[model samples]
Target: MKRRAHLAGLLALPMFWLIGIYIFSLVMLLVTAFWTTDPFTSKVKPGFTLRNFEQLVANPAYLSTAVRTLVIALAVTVLCMLISVPLGIFMAKIAKPWLRALLAVAITLPLWAGYLVKILAMRVTFTDAGFFNWALAPFGITGPSFSITTVVLTLTYLWLPYMAVPVYTAIRQLPANLFDASADLGAGAWRTIRTIVLPLIKPAIIAGSIFTFSLSLGDYIAAKFVGGSTQMIGSIIASNINLNPPIAAAFAVVPIAFVVIYLLSVQRTGALERM
Candidate 1:
């Protein structure tokens, strides 16, 4: 009884800290959202109102930018899944341990080499006279410059490894006997995969998708650097922070909402228990 109580108290400590930070931040935002600056005095007036949300809703540009962020985030998430799923299966199901290990290392090592520098390298190759265009110039394939495409591609490169790692681990942990049993029962490769493998690995897919979506949504640096005029929620919040704290708070909360909902769904699905 005493042990249970002590453990409960210990667990409560971090939860308390997290709750305190969230509540404190929310309160500050509520206060600042209502604050009015005196015209002549340049002093802040502590009050309450709904001007921030009203302004956010009324501004078409803000709404459009938010939509663009969600669209791009969805695109990135889908692309990561499409790329990682096959790669993870190949790496996990390969007959040789050395081959699997080499592929795993290849997929993972580039992640630690600094993401910003990778974005810069991508930018360098896309320049008109850069290597990519230089190679294509001889083939007479030229077109207008692209910034949005560059940003999306850069983010995909950055997050593909994150998606691959989890899916690979999930696939590797799956029982080898299950595959053999299915084959012995005259199940084809695709049939075995569809019936036995997919359900087991769905949890990993969920995890990887959550990571890819959340990271891409919350990321400020990549959106700001590669995204040029492609305004996203991150930059929107940044712009509003000093000038309009309440609205910025609202913008930041959207991503937090996504993360919380995803976490709750994962918990309900017992997805993380396997991890």
Candidate 2:
């Protein structure tokens, strides 16, 4: 009884905050999604209606923006996976102890810097006379103008550490003897990675992907800075929030639904258990 009481005491404050504040806000937002706002008065009038959702479904621009955001999110995840896997392997399996430590620091350094600063830096880099174009001039390759390609590249840059760190940790946790055993059986390095390492690291990759996908899905600031006129679901929500909150709420639910569905899919793959 005493131990149970103590445990409950420890959980009391956080539970109150989560349930009372966080969950309560989410409930309010979802409830508001079914509500209507008065156009003449510009005020939220609470009543049940599915019209907001219908509008979301019917709007061609909204549909395109949602599709565009989804594509960007998937691209970010794929790009992160491609970059992180081999880099993770090198950091975990090949680097000397000092080199590993240095690499870890290098990987984590960007996260310590402000996100806005990094985005701004990328903005400068992609400009016509910026370092990217200047460096590529000799190769006759033009820098990507402010476009979807730039958005993908910037997002991938921002989220790479999130994927790489977790993957590196997973690879490092793997037993060294597994590699030795695979090699003893005459499996080459590529074969061992495909048959052995890939299976074991699948969970960690999925874990990292959760962060990359969800963040990319909701990002508005990066898109605004580098996307030119391109708009994401978040940008649309921000635009409509004060004027038509119900519509914003309705749109807000899309990414949440996408994330929930994604998590469910990943759950079925059993990758979450590894995390």
Cα-based RMSD of candidate 2: 1.1
Q: Judge candidate 2 at residue 139 and give its lDDT.
A: 94
Clash count per candidate: 0, 0
Evaluate model 1: give its lDDT: 0.76
Segments of candidate 1 deviating more than 4 angstroms: 1-5, 26-31, 34-45, 135-145, 259-275
TM-score (C-alpha) between model 1 and the true structure: 0.82
Per-residue C-alpha lDDT of model 2 across residues 1-275, encoded as one tens digit per residue: 99999999999999999999999999999999999999977699999999999999899988899999999999999999999999999999999999999999999999999999999999999988999999999999998889899999999999999999989999998899999999999999999989998899999899899999999999998899999888999999999999999999999999998999999999998888768
After superposition of all CA atoms, the RMSD between model 1 and the true structure is: 3.3
Give the TM-score comparing model 2 with the true structure, all chains together: 0.97
Position 227, candidate 2: lDDT: 91
lDDT at residue 213 of model 2 (Cα atoms): 100
- The candidate that wins on TM-score is 2
